[model samples]
Target: MTSLPARLYRALALGWLASKAVVLLVNAVTFPRLHPSRPSLRPRVSLLVPARNEARALPHTLPGLLAQGADEVIVLDDESTDGTGIVAGCLGAQVIRGEPRPDGWYGKPWACQQLWRAASGDVLVFVDADVIWQPGALDAVLHGLEHTGADLLSVQPRQRPVTVGERLLTPLVDNAVLSYFPYPLIGLPQPAASMANGQVMALRRRALEEAGGFAAVRQVVLDDTEFARHLKARGRRLAVALGGPLIGVRMYASYPQSVAGYAKNVLPLHLGSRPLLLLSAVAHLAVYTLPWLVRVPGWRVLRVAGLLERVAANVISGRTRPADLLEGLLGPLTPLLALPVYARALRRTVSWKGRTYPQKAR
Candidate 1:
């Protein structure tokens, strides 16, 4: 027999699911797509990639950018122990050695600052080494920027989670961008409504300048988020689109790598405050794990709705697979699976790609 607390939990979970479902459905109808643009006046685009020990990904990613007909493809080799510069040079990219990291500057923003200075195009595209772009993605991004009149544009790529660990965690968070935030507000005149994915960001040169540029945000971990906020602060538009078929990002290679990769970014961002973090953990557990608390077929309505909401959100976002759709129904297991990551974040030490960034408690 189901207890009183269990019954009450399911009811509350249903309400949360219903709200998220409404968000997913509403954003799907309103969010813009990035198709080809044929505007008469097109800005000159320079593709810049900041790479640190990314030799494994360069060969596959470079060709995709080269095929885009971009005016230039420049790669900043940020003191890689691997022959990243040589690999970029061999692949026909204009390779530049990134300057040493300044005392307070983070590695990525420092690399990006150098790349932006070197780029001569009116438009600058910062692509992550691991992100793969389709043949005409650049044109579509240019089109999206022009159509929305956004000073900065970012397309959250279709996340391909091949590993078992990824199938469990990836799809759930994938829904975050569209599931919670209002699509129209992202471009409106409010920093509160802005968001961006660092993997593939395109910005107008003037907009970056007016927004205080990469150097201004050099020490920040949430670089893309700050970019969106700054751009919106300058009264410039910022657009975020779903890049389903046009782009794909392979986030991690294995389960262990996935844990580290996610914890480094996720923990600090969500768990910065002790009270908020504790409240968030409990809320996540109460809602997501609520379905797991009871396994009866009759009371599975809340679980079913939660699962379907995730599936519908992913499908609407344009990154759904048949397996992932079914796998995502187990969405309730996410917060539980992510417990270790949450714990690691609290420890104040995070590692990524051979670099260690110690988190300073707020």
Candidate 2:
């Protein structure tokens, strides 16, 4: 009636906040800058970008990449209907026209696999086409790799939201991983505790080949997360740090684009288990939405706690748009909104870049 026991929200809320604190701490320490002075002997770096109709995005990202310390840059145009291949070539990148997607392989993994095979550098940097690297980003990436001794490192890009849909859903980007999983655990060589953002991932050539590369996760929709797990299984060290300041990606341009993307990936994030899906849906909705029911006693406390969590998460994520923060904190229907998206995602066959994968892609 009035309120679910404070026991309910307090338990999940405290756990959520505590993990956020850990995420912030780890990110603050681990996010390296382009070493004030460059290293004496940095490994030859190869920048690999997987493009699918990325003509619009390549202009923003490719120029920054070309200026990096990497010895070579390659772009795999994954059967783009647009001028992705032409654009990539004109930008001075060695453009590799992507082959048709093989059966049982996802588009991104296939393209990345192709790029990895052709790469000439000791270190392979896989950047999403949408990502725009700030100056010194490549140096910072190398710094992170050298300092951590990590075989695989993923830099979660800072989100730049131009649309309302992005502002609301992008929290799930960090919140999804950072809230449930601790960064320390993710850093360990444990298959069960692993995370990575495919947008800006780096892998040592030897380790990547040794671990079977994208071929290991050819069928996974959550390609990056699964890639990190595969590397962990091979006993390779894993490291993930903040890349918001180092790079930015506007993940979704419009509401439909945002919804469609999430629909394909979000539900399966729980491993296609309906019960876990339902449970998460209920819990998330209750925490943010139910507390807004002011008729309930002590409701303001619950509301405040939920808002604070969002604010802190936004701050840590480096999304400082006051309007976005205010809208995110005050708009408590995210989970309720998310429920239909996930449900629709579950029901529909997932399609991207003119190819379709099964609803629960293996």
Candidate 3:
């Protein structure tokens, strides 16, 4: 007979799994997805890329942006040691030297503020330098913004994780969004339901100005979500969508880079509360790991449910890689691998792109 404590744990695990299953069911239909649209009624667009030591990445990503038919393409070389500015200029983008980030400002937000000031377009598209903009990507995003009547549209570009470590960890990023967020609430005008992806975001210039622009989130490392929340709080229209083949990003090249990259955002995701972070780690281990290892009640059922949820998440999020479905089966291992990330995020500071920022819950 199962002991009382064991039975209780089983109940909790099964309950959590069931909750995620329900979320997946809802998001399957309601989640917005983007596909390439024919350019029409074109608004003046300023394509902005914030690059830091991204000389190598610019060669692959910048060409796509330049070909997007934007009124102007601008790349801010954020004091990169690697000839980021020169490469962007050669690629036919108007390169701007970013001013040094002021005290109490995070690097990306500071760089973005400079880009925002320089842009003279009805639509402001902020894209990371590492993203690959497939043909018609910008048009589709703009169409999404206009169709939804949103002031800001944040897109989760399809992830292309090639390495073993990347395959293991990267798919989980979409899982968090696809399996948790209440999709219906996302459309409602409320800050609590807001979400955003910094990988690719398109904003109307007027909406950005009303929301106080990038300066509103200058200090926080998780600038995207905070900025989205700020916009939503001020009654700005917001939308989140999946970028199918139209946009792609390989955010980290190796296992270690993936670990460090995730660590920087993990604490911020938990709102910088040590107790909350600790609780999350323990909950993930219990909810994700124990269901696979122990032959407890409903263990096999839980495993199958978890895998299906993962695969469904991939499909719903527009991840087209065949490997992603296989990686979905490896979803249970993500919590175990993310243990190191959780540990690193517990520190007082985190580093990214040669800059270290003090971590604090705002």
Instruction: Note each model's CA RMSD in angstroms.
Output: 2.4, 2.8, 1.5
**Candidate 1 lDDT tens digits, 306-344:** 667778877876765677677766678777887876776
Model 3, which residues run further than 4 Å from truth?
none
Q: Spell out the clash pairs found in candidate 1.
A: none
Candidate 2 structure quality by residue, lDDT tens digits, 1-362: 43567556666755654565576566545444333335446998999999999999889889999998689999998888889999999989999998887888888889999999889999999999988887888888888888888998888777787767667676567655544565667655569788888888889999998987789989878888888888888889988777767777888887677777787787668787666777778877766787676434445665776676666556666777777578556448777667667677656478766778876633
**What overall lDDT, based on C-alpha atoms, would model 3 receive against the true structure?**
0.87
What lDDT does the true structure give each of the candidates?
A: 0.79, 0.77, 0.87
In candidate 2, what residue range of length 10 has the lowest lDDT sum?
Answer: 31-40
Comparing 2 and 3 on lDDT, the stronger one: 3
TM-score leader = 3
Model 1 residue-pair collision total: 0
Q: Pairs clashing in candidate 3?
A: none
**Number of the predicted model whose lDDT against the real structure is largest:** 3
The regions of model 1 sitting more than 4 angstroms off are: 1-11, 295-299
Deviation (Å) of 88 in candidate 2: 1.4
